[model samples]
Target: MEKPLLVTDFLDRARRYYGDREAIVATTGDRYTYDEFGARADGFAAALADRGIEKGDRVAVLDPNTHYHLEAAYGIMQLGAVHTPLNYRLVPDDFEYILEDAGVDAIYADYEHAEKIEAVRDEVPTETFVTNDTDAVDGDWESFDELVDTDETFERPKMDENDVITINYTSGTTGDPKGVCRTHRTETLHAYIVSLHQEIRDDDVYLWTLPMFHVNGWGHIFAVTGMGATHVCTRGVDAGGIFEAIRTEDVTYLCGAPTVLNMLVDYYERHDVATTGDRDVRIATAGSAPPEAVIRAVEDDFGWYLKHVYGATETGPLITTSDARRFFEDGSDARFAVKKRQGLGYLGTEVRVVDEDGTDVPEDDATLGEVVVRGNQVMDRYWNKPEATEEAFTDRIEGYYHTGDLATVDENGMIAIRDRKKDIIISGGENISSIELEDTLYEHDAVADVAVIPAPSSEWGETPKAFVVPTSGDPDEPGTDVDELVSFTRAHLATYKAVSKVEFVESLPTTATGKVQKYELRQREWDEEDRMIGEG
Candidate 1:
């Protein structure tokens, strides 16, 4: 049977087929079934309609991973309004820019983040402010819990498959954030593609560790619910809490960034953990390509299968998968090496590595070029910005969306990421991938987090310097020292990728979505230069 291509159809099917099944367990000890979830969503939809929320209007949500956030997503989508998920960690100015840019009609913000929106709400086009936290009500703002208590039910609005459903703002390293507008068709197809690669099943219990505001949590909301799987809402990404949730809730699947994986490995090592539950859990990691050591630990130490994926917010977030390959008949070690490359494109996606003129790069496993993609899952356009949207799809060889990421295609057609066009560090007429040095430095025992950028060198034109966060603050800790870290890297990776200088910090700068702001780190080194090192 064919269902509507919209997300509301997915939610309705889950409620009809799995109404008795648990859909969410909040950190505050609240639980909801598919029926209850749908009812809450419907109630909020009615409430929004009362406040003049019409189809095609923009409703922005700023909150952490919670049941409230999920309900807001369904409610907005049900009304045929485009849901713009905001990163709550953004500063007041960033929030101001996005709300004004999208021309949002209403904003649903968590209690902790309400003030940031309130500070500039008057300047934005928004007419309503719905507070998610019970304690965050002002004279003009409405309470989220009050909306849930309403008994009104609104009919789901009629929607075309290609209608815009969501707009996600990406944190590009060197420019202002661009809103990636995705249609119902694009989002649904991406869920199917990601589910195939992730092996999502009906019995899977998924823990929402990844931020739901990030590419709609990589489109898992539709994928998991469509499979009749259970979701456990997590308030924070604490390792202890995640471990307990997996053990108690029988969680089977989850996804996060490489930084999240790093946190898990660090916690597991320091605490000497055994098992989260009797069964092994599967985790999908992206945001940054993980090192081989992190992959090994997830398999050997944690007994979890870590799947690596690569994508940006513009690609509906599912471009490729790095799973087991057929040509690795040699052994597991060699096989793991191949799996590290971002694998072939998903079902409806076409990926190519192309040179400067958009010519295909040879698959000799050495020739590096920018990755260009074209797919049904690609974003429709940047919201309200035709120039940026045109630029994003420009210079297309047969209508491909040019990804700014640089990579190398292997003989087996697996894509190994080399660097971003903006992130390459050139030193003494030699080009280096900052990712290479950061990956090498991640192996250091003391480095909890690391970002490599080009530093001004008196001899070499530019050299790699690492800004690192030690696992333990004390440098005198048994295994924590800068010299030891440098020595470890020198032994592991090539000499060029070794960290030239290390600065111990409490933490590296990060965006609202948790990606390390390496451009900011690079700016500290390149302010006086006549030219930036990498773009040439």
Candidate 2:
């Protein structure tokens, strides 16, 4: 007999089996057991119910990677309301759009970001606003501390596995942010696969370096807690702070973007710091593939295992991983190549690299195609956009979520994302991968961060342009000149793929999740050319 897979089951099981175990190590140095955490969640659920929040209402959470996020999320989910978590880095305009679009009924923003919501209170439909520190926020908001201390208990509603329990908004890189609707089954299965691949165990200590708002911290909120692991909370991540947490809290595993790994490596190089604690540490990086050099330094120099995974918010945000030990030879240079690719699909996930005509690309590792995926973890649809939903699933395939990521499939069927479909620079009828160019440039010591975008070219239609953030952190005096860097890329890669133009910047603009905002750079480069190209 099979039981219904509800997201609430995770916390229930943890409370039932590991009730007395330490559940969370808060950023404020406060600790909580599973029993206490569960009680707080129940209290928040009661508070929402007291405020007349129904099962189908939408509740938004705006906070960092803190325990409050977990409590508010589970609290909202227990009532079967849609748990809508906002990106903390989003401004008031972005918040207003999402809040109104989702028809959010109530919101819980951290004291640090509550002002953004207050700035747009009249613009959105949301009514109830709560913050952890009401006195600190100059608004008509209630204290979350008081709200979660409700004496009345709430009765959880009967929820189906297929109900849209979460509505995750996209980053709106290309257009308006669309809400990705996901069901309980989708989230639960995603959590299960995350647990299996990340190798989470009860004795493990998970450091919250990743933002909890991002796909629910890539679904670790359920996966890690369900496994009865200790959660070491972090307010924000820095190289020094991350290392200190690892040593002080005995962190064994964590997840972050490639930028976070680079930060840790750079800090480790500049300062002598311990890398691990009492237990061997493992780090999983995604949002983009980490350079093999960073991966090697992480594994060899820092003495930590590195796993490269890939996915998007529309999907489970973790459909593939490069943790296949069979291909990995510990302490061998050959294994870095395998670890660099976004490895095979997770169990029950079908990831395919397909051509424009919807046929699978040859597994020769040279052909580029769009990556599409179909799995139980994939989102059901956009919140209210049927046309957009239809186009997303039926774009190049009938039943798969179009990832819009161009990738190549190797002989072993492991996929490596080359570039985004729009980011692929078409110069003189030749497709130049911006990722390849950026990767080549990353090998240079003068480059601290880099973004490669397609710029209008007089002869080639479009040429690859490089925006380099120097190691010296000054744009005016980039240590290395354009000619030297151009020669460096020419020596490492094909001449056509080399950057035709270079611009030095203080830093590259990135998303809250630490992904370079190449769209911004592309817009700035193409802004004036649009009129000229159109006239031509």
Name the top lDDT candidate: 2
lDDT of 2 by residue, 57-107 (tens): 999999998889999999999999999999886668779899999999999
- What ranges in model 2 sit over 4 Å off? 423-536
TM-score of each: 0.79, 0.81
Top-scoring candidate (TM-score):
2
Local distance difference test, candidate 1? 0.79
Question: Candidate 2 local accuracy as lDDT?
Answer: 0.86
Clashing pairs in 1: none
Looking at candidate 2, the ten consecutive residues that score lowest on lDDT are 527-536
Per-model C-alpha lDDT, please? 0.79, 0.86
Cα displacement (Å) at residue 223, model 2: 0.4
